[model samples]
Target: MKALSSYLTPVRACGAWLLMTLTGGGAACAQAPQEATQDRMVAKVNGAPILVSDLKQVTDAQTQGIRYQFADDPTKLANEMAAVKLNALDTLIDCQLLADEFYKIGGVMKPEFLEQDLTQIIQMGFRGDREAFMADLAQNGLALEKFRELRERILIMNVMRARIAGTVEVTEESLQEHYEKNLRRWSGPGKVKLHTVTISKKTADARSVADSLHTKLADGGDFEEIARKSSADSHATRGGEWNWLDPTDLTGTVSEVVLATKQGEISEVIEQLDAFIIVRVDDRQEGDPKPFESVKNEVTKSLMDEVSKGRIAERMIHLRAAADIQRMGAD
Candidate 1:
């Protein structure tokens, strides 16, 4: 499975900053000698220099995807790039303003949390190659120290969320209403308690192995024992027992075969990827609506999620209003 960071790309938040830094002429300004560039300013956020190098990195990273989209049309590509650059600059200025406000409001990550998050990001994003990841960040024109500061700001935003959006509660009446409205979707044809054995073609002749198991089962041999000895599945060690899974949860062919069988009956050798499977329907239950009392907790959790989303949205609006936001080139 891909790591969470690999999918979410939290590092892209810093990429946003890098985009603005590059397009806002921060890179060129940074390259100029300090003595000669003393009076020159690219852009400023509450008197802090938005360096030329910072702008270049951010713009370069952010524009990479846009560049690909318009690869076939240079004129359209230039227009898109220009728009992306302006938007990126505005976004960076807003982010910096928010971070400044976040600090003012006593928003900060605990040292331990910062270290743990950084470790997780490194492990998930860089696959434990911290030095190489740092080098890549440098090549993208991001400073390790500045990126850490950005991470800290993000952590603080989360902290603000926790402080503002407290616990959510779901009422029993709302849950009952939802249950009544959506109960049809949960109903099914029936349930099956199945005993299954799988043999991979790589390990043995699938047809021969399945035939042997069928004979053993017919002779009243221990089903679990036969499964343990012959099945090539990872679950073979546990006697090929799959906890009573819903037919709907099973793959199309497996579901069709299992649903067709009667209790105490076995399936014909069913072919799957690299293997043949034998399934026995041990027990069955027809689908029925679960009593409201039985699933009240689940219903309550769903309602709470809805309430939490609304509260978070409201909180974000308030935070944005109270924040001292000044966009450098928004006009």
Candidate 2:
């Protein structure tokens, strides 16, 4: 989103100008300062200085994850980190441009809300002490008025985003198109519903008990009733009802037994280390491709959000074109 390229200014000059413009002039900035680190002016958006420290705050967080990913390749890691820094600075510039645009349009927030937020912060963070708040601001090298101005910038940017999003419109045709485009996502996964009866190995004559139950179930016995009365599994209280689940997640022989069993039919006695079990294949739920009508509201909302995001990006492009953005030492 860089509106224009910029040259690197001497650290002393940059620092001095910042002080002069921002703080109403200070001591002499006649001499070159020490080798600038994070205090270096990395970019400027409409004359607003973007320090390396601001860019670092964003890139450092991203590099933590990226570093681990390219741990063995230092060159790759460095390249990725550099890209992250550049992108972070670009995003910061975008934010500045948006905030400037908001202000240029004479956007104003209610004074009461800003004061209420400041009051809440004071009460909760500083125990309602005005002196403590002032002292904390001073410690951070900030004045009360400057801090309020920064906070208002954040508030204004948020309102600007909301206003841009409000301009987006959604139609039923768009909803249907989006739903069809992502048909696979809207479709349900294949699953099964099951019932079980378990006979614990610790029970005397466990094999006999399992055989009897299996036979009863095969002969049109009430599976729920049999499971409730005989099952030793945790789900025995629920008549051995298992939730609709993907059979692939079931381990070892249980998966085989369930997959082999026909729908609405009972499984044979399955022997396990801890127990003998039988199951009923209550239902096989194959992936059901959803109709557009069934998920119309969800699709509509998703399409609206996507379109709104595109609109915002377009807005940023316009803002950038009208903006004065400069990045130092970037070809």
Q: Which predicted model would earn the best lDDT? A: 2
| Cα lDDT tens digits for candidate 1, 1-331 | 1222221122212321111111211111112224324533446655555545445545666566555655654434666689867765554554454455455554444456666677767776778888867776675555666556545544444444444456775566788897787674345656778888887878656678777888888778888998898888777877777777788787646787787788888777776656778888888887887787787776676667666657866755665576544434332
Candidate 2 displacement at residue 13 in angstroms = 38
Alpha-carbon lDDT, every model: 0.60, 0.66
For the record, the alpha-carbon RMSD of candidate 2 to the native fold, in angstroms, is 17.3
Please give each candidate's TM-score.
Answer: 0.41, 0.45
Return the top candidate by TM-score.
2
Model 2: per-residue lDDT, tens digit, 67-180? 666665443466677887667767667667766766556544445766765776577667788788777666444455545544444445555666676765767777777998
In model 1, the runs with Cα more than 4 Å from the true position are: 1-105, 110-113, 178-302
